[model samples]
Target chain A: SQQGEEDPQALSIQEGENATMNCSYKTSINNLQWYRQNSGRGLVHLILIRSNEREKHSGRLRVTLDTSKKSSSLLITASRAADTASYFCATDASRLWDDMRFGAGTRLTVKP
Target chain B: DTEVTQTPKHLVMGMTNKKSLKCEQHMGHRAMYWYKQKAKKPPELMFVYSYEKLSINESVPSRFSPECPNSSLLNLHLHALQPEDSALYLCASSLPGQGPSGNTIYFGEGSWLTVV
Candidate 1:
């Protein structure tokens, strides 16, 4: 079973625009992580935000966590055509220390 | 090395054929995982090995068997698979134990399997 669900299943935007993807989970989580996957390859870890943290940034990527609302969002500033890929949100539930469940994912296409 | 490597990048097998998927990581990660992903779907957890011990099975079918020969290697043996079982097999690894930090998991380029 998937613990998280991403909104806006698909999004398309022009280069230089910003892309934002949201995720909502059901249970309390110790942490939430965002990942990116190219067309036929495995996923790559993007960023991780702890439950206690509100927001974090890496390069042009920004991630925000809202534990009160059980939701998180990932924002890509100055999106480029290379940013086109599928993004997933994985949650490590507070109850389970070893298992992490991934969401359906958001497919973002950056048009050049 | 800090990467996970998987062999036989693509495989085609018959229902009665028996084959195996191999994964190796040199990062010394104590936890390894196997995940199955169908087209356009999120990868599903299949098995997990921690410290060279089987920790989680995820209720996977009997036809699939997982092996951890050492801390640096994991293998999944497949047999009697149906056509519906065709999908990408992904291997991943992360630091041992739980934490809100420094436990970022890394994945390898998945093995594309086609069952006929």
Candidate 2:
């Protein structure tokens, strides 16, 4: 089953703008990881934030986790046309490796 | 390559056809998983194999059988599948040694299966 849900099923932005997408889950999570999937392709790992950490960043991406709300957000600063893709957030429990579930995803289309 | 590889980028089969999806990884990982996704839904776990042994099965239908030939290869056999079963099948692998604190999975270029 899917453990999380991402809001704004679709987001369109102009290049050089910032794109923000949010995800909310239902259960306690050990860690949350974000991924990017291009049209008709596999997924690529973007970033992973542990339960102890509140915020993390990688390149042009920033991720924040709020355990109380069971929600997380991914912010892409200075978005580019190449950043156009579907983003998914996956939650993994602290128990086992297979105890992970992914959210629906948010489609971001960045136009130049 | 730092990636999981799945064979047959695209597949089309009829309701009575029998086919198989293959996945390979050379990342020296101990665990592999199979996930199925519909048009706009998220990937759902179907099976998980750890240390070359089937460890997790999500009560998936018996018509779908999974096989692990070796530590580097996995296969999913499809038989008597419904048209609704057509979707993107993904394969992922991860080193499940560090527990949850460091659990990360790498995915392959999923195989798009269409059952007509």
Candidate 3:
């Protein structure tokens, strides 16, 4: 079974608008990571937030995690048309190696 | 460097044909993974290799065999595949540990497989 589930399957906005995506998980996680995937391409690591940390920022990206709610949100500020891609949240619930499970993903379209 | 490279970016094979997908990483990551993704879907975990040994197998079919030749190379051998098996095969690698850095997986460009 998939560990994470994302909401608002699709979103559309202007180039300068901010885009937000939410993800809910079923189990406890040591870390939650966000990845971006272009069409017909592989995933690219975006940001990772530890369970002990509530929020993290990188460049124009902001990620928030709520362990109690078992959810996480990824916010992309000042989005660009190049930022249009599918964003997925992956949860690492295992204590051993990388046992990351990903969500269905939210497709974001930034119109120029 | 920090890239996980995969060969044969696109492939087409018949149900009876045999093929192999190769992945390599030069970052010295000990953990490697294989994932299958369908259109508009999340990538599914297929296999995981740690320290050149198979650590996790998600009950993948026998026709899909994964091999870790060393710490830097991983390969997936395919045989007698069904059309439904056609999808994007992704190769990823990361450090082996419990820390946040260890969980950050670097992915290759992926191989688009079409089983006819």
Candidate 4:
């Protein structure tokens, strides 16, 4: 499977705390993207890091990619209750085709 | 607010019924996709259409037929579906190419399908 694997299937944290999720994939990728999906909702693109880039940050989210390790991580700073959602890491394995595969995702809960 | 839009936010159909889930995007993205997501699971790629052409099928079952009428519109024609086929159908679009902007896929709110 081209899908990535995410650690900590579920995580619980309080507001003002930081929540981190890690992902590992098996194949070479052009880029890795992180998405957030609320329950029964559509996914929202969070950030994207290329294989050449090590780290990228967007607003309260930080994403790191290590192609050598075939792993990536996402960190949400100052988590809020509204931050509760499932975070997924997607890998674009084929450069010619849009064959993007997704990880199982990490369910995050932030308490007020 | 996502630029991609999907119709029939919720659908309930029988095994013998035939239905079509509609998706549209005005962003002028050359690539469109359909994804099936089960409860608590990640979205599975069902089909990909680039430049209004079927580029990848992902070996999807025949019961799920994907159609791209134009660059801005995509549809999934469902027929004789099993109960297991019930899932959240997501529609997405992206610019066709590499790089951050090209790889970034914009998804619709999704349609909830329930096969009875």
Candidate 5:
């Protein structure tokens, strides 16, 4: 079963704009990770934010986690057409075996 | 290397054919996983191997068997699969003994499968 649901199932924006995707999960988690997948390819790990961390940034990617709300948001600043892909959020829920559950994903298209 | 290598990037098999998908990781990760993904959908966990042991099976069918011979090699043996089972099969691995929340998981480029 899927654990997380990403809002804005699909988004399209002009280049240089900022794209934000939100995710909400049902259970408590140890950490939240965001990944990007190009068409027909493997997932690329973007950034990880632990439960205790409220925000993190990597390059143009900024991730904010709200443990109290069991939600997280990923922001891609200065988006480019190369950023076109599906973004997914995964949560561990502190499982011993590392069974990460992924969200439905947000399809972001940066129009150049 | 840090990559997960998956073999037969594309596969087309008959319903009665028996085929195997192989994955290898040299990053010394102890946990390996198999996930099935339909187009535009999130990948679903099918199996997990921790320390070369079968740790989690998400009630996958009997026809889909997973083998982890060692810490570096993982294989998914397929037999008598239906057309509906055709999808992108992904293999991923993470650091030794780390929970999903503990480390980043590296994914293969997914084997595209089609069952006729």
Candidate 6:
């Protein structure tokens, strides 16, 4: 079963625009991580935000975790054409340590 | 090396033909995983190996066999696969225990399998 679900199944924007994707999970999670995939290829680690922390930033990526609402969001600042890809959020909870479920993912396309 | 490598970037096999997907990682990660992904779907956990031991099975079909020869290698054996079984076979690795701080997974390019 999938623990996390990403909203806005697809998003398209210009090269300089910002891309924001949201994810919601069911259970109390220890941490949530985001990944990027090009086409049908494997995933690439983007950023990780823990339950204890409310928000985090890495380069142009900003991740915010809202445990109260059981949701998280990934913000890509100044998106580029190369940033166009499928973004997925994975949730790792307490009970299921080894079982990390991924969301359906959000497809973001940055038009150049 | 810090990356995971998989062999046979693409594979085509018949319904009755048997083939195996190989994955290797030199990051010394204690845990390895096999995930099956269909088009427009998220990767599904098939099997997990921790410290050379099969930890989680996810109730995957018996036709899909997983092997961990050593700490640095993981293999998925496929046999009698159906047409719907054709999908991307991805290999990922992470640190054994938990916590996103120390346990971040790295994935390979994946093996695209087409069953005909």
- What is the alpha-carbon interface RMSD for each candidate? 1.5, 1.3, 1.7, 2.1, 2.0, 1.8
lDDT of each: 0.92, 0.90, 0.93, 0.91, 0.93, 0.90
Report lDDT (Cα) of residue B102, candidate 6: 32
Fnat of each prediction, in sequence: 0.50, 0.63, 0.67, 0.53, 0.63, 0.47
DockQ of candidate 3 against the true complex: 0.70
Give lDDT tens digits, candidate 4, residues B1-116: 35899999999999999999999999879999999999999999989998999988889999999999999999999999999999999999998876444398899999999999
Q: lDDT score, residue A48, model 4?
A: 86
lDDT (tens digit, per residue) of candidate 6 on A1-112: 7888998999999999999999999998888999999997889999888889999999999999999999999999999999999999998766555677789899999999
State residue B64's C-alpha deviation in candidate 2, in Å.
Answer: 0.8
DockQ of each: 0.66, 0.70, 0.70, 0.61, 0.66, 0.62
Tens-digit lDDT track of model 4 for A1-112: 4479999999999999999999999888888999999999999999988888999999999999998999999999999999999999999875554888899999999999
Model 6 clashing residue pairs (backbone): none
**Candidate 5 Cα misplacement greater than 4 A, ranges:** B99-101
| Prediction-by-prediction clash tally | 0, 0, 0, 0, 1, 0
What residue pairs clash in candidate 1, if any at all?
Answer: none
Tally clashes: model 2.
0
- A2-91: candidate 3 lDDT, tens digit per residue: 889998899999999999999999988888999999999989999988888999999999999999999999999999999999999999
> What's model 1's lDDT at B4?
95
Per-model TM-score on C-alpha atoms: 0.97, 0.96, 0.97, 0.96, 0.98, 0.97
Better of 1 and 6 by TM-score: 1
Candidate 1 chain A: minimum summed lDDT over ten consecutive residues — where? Answer: A92-101
Itemize residue pairs with steric clashes in candidate 4: none
Pairs clashing within candidate 5: A98-B100
Candidate 3 — which pairs collide?
none
Worst ten-residue run, lDDT, model 6 chain B?
B95-104
